[model samples]
Target: MPVTSVEKDLNTLSMTIVADFASPLQRLWDAYADPRQISKFWGPVEWPATFVRHDMATGGRSHYYMTGPNGERSDGYWEFTAVNAPHSFEVNDGFANEDGTPNDMMPSMKMKFEFEETANGSRMTNTATFGSVEQLQQLIEMGMEEGTRSAMSQIDAVLEDLATFAAGKGTELQILSDTQVRITRVIRGTAPQVWDAHNEPELMKRWLLGPDGWTMPVCEVAQEPGEQYRQEWENTKTKERFGFEGELLESAAPYRSVTTEKMIGMEGPSTQNELTFTPVDGGTLLTLVITYPDVATRDMVLATGMTDGMETSYLRLENEVLASAE
Candidate 1:
């Protein structure tokens, strides 16, 4: 168990947990920074977590849910108040509704996580401040302390599993649920460079083409929130064309963007795509969470070899667009 100590102060209306890890500072930090690794241990062993949106920056928000053994789910949200990279971060944590909004009936708490280099490896101090002593007592009675202990106990496994989430793994896909999926890849470039490749029309046209035979003839990029963008591709030999159009719902430059996407002529519900970029050890970690309208729609889309096509485009982005810039 990595948890060294747990403290609760009624006078201060706070609880603090300190945990030490054998992994290096960056490794410990990455375990939390990367959603793939964090999702493995954020919740207790019995109630595993699935993060749909994790933006680890100031003014950002994260939406995740824990699934119980019997298919029950408890949603949560984190509003990041401060982020100092590998050192520390603070968030307002609270229960969330299915629609990713805060639940006002449930009490929210402020949490600060501080990381530091220890003699053997690293240490993380987590402090949660409740609004009132009654709130603190209520959470304690609800097994918050025990739950946190169990959650932190599982982190050791995630921290040591370096090979699984490391760079060069190519594009990886995780079916988060029936209606949501997460796609992640580590591109060989900085976050800004990767974000530019995604937003700049010229750069996107060069590398966003999924396969070798496809040419992006029309690339109308959206520069801000509420703006609609269109993308079309044509086969080189057959000239067969298809396109997608969407409105940018949210934009956090160089870090995150959320857009609603749909086939140009299709008459069905659209998908909300949330993209996040984080600077990692090797390069930039690009995570895209797509929320489908239903299980049937998700399955239909995955049947089209979407992940494989995405991998091809990512490889091209690294080699053809980013590498040439170097």
Candidate 2:
């Protein structure tokens, strides 16, 4: 209903759809920037999406999958080529394999999304350019138009539910698959500040302690890729101590980081952790995606009160570290 027009230009081998929404331009832009909000309506009603990774920056990539009614799944990916923020962005969109690699057998397209503020609300222009006429016709035959319409129709509900994704919601855990889990929390601080808090030893020791009785004794942060980092925490009263060490695999300053983590002194497969910080309406949306060695390891980690402890640490970060900065 929000769609005003859907045009197919055979000469240019492109398809364009323009839709109007009853929300501010920033709100509409944020819907796409935040993975949690975008996943809610990125697929057809029957095929809900789960975005395991979303980095809204140039050269960044997003990985998501849509699940069908009968448990079928279709994976997709987007490589951001240009990101102008709140107005327009361009990406190379394509189908992906189960391992999150591009499916070259399927046609990929150059897609651009433009947003603007209208008198009533906002408008979004989505244009996808195919390599050839045959490719465009192929996607059209694959129910591309119908699927997009269904996806856009569900965005109204997500736009109106503003408070759900706002700040102070605490740490949220989402199981993306048997091996992957995503933890999200809106920290009341800027992305740079939040990133620094995690990277700086002094700042981390001030807030990374889980509970009131715990104290961080050692806080060694990895400054760059291939660098090893270690952190140790102790129960102040009981004198119990434990630690974790990891080598940084990737780093993008205030935006994203990937690392391999293992409990120090333990012998087992390590987990891969991907962290991303995105600026939102309230503050920074900190997302951590952890891939365990297996389902058993995933479930075991969750059963250890990991989420609750994370929430406590995040709260301390807001109150002690960020609040002091303000």
Q: What clash count goes with each model?
A: 0, 0
Q: Candidates' TM-scores?
A: 0.97, 0.96
Segments in model 1 whose C-alpha atoms lie over 4 Å from true places: none
Task: Please give the lDDT score for candidate 2.
Answer: 0.93
Candidate with top TM-score is: 1
RMSD of every prediction: 1.2, 1.3
Candidate 1 structure quality by residue, lDDT tens digits, 1-326: 99999999888889999999999988888888899988999999889998888999899999899999999999999999999989999999999998789999988899999999999999999999999988888888888999998999899999988889879889998998899999999999998899999999999999998979999999998888999999999999999999999999999989999999999999988999999998878888999999999999999999999999999999999999999988
Q: Quote the lDDT for 211 in model 2.
A: 76
> What is the TM-score of candidate 2?
0.96
Model 2 pairs whose backbones collide: none
- Give per-residue lDDT, candidate 1, residue 32: 87
Q: Positional deviation of 65 in candidate 2, in angstroms?
A: 1.0
Error of 2 at 133 (Å): 1.4
- lDDT, candidates in the order shown: 0.93, 0.93
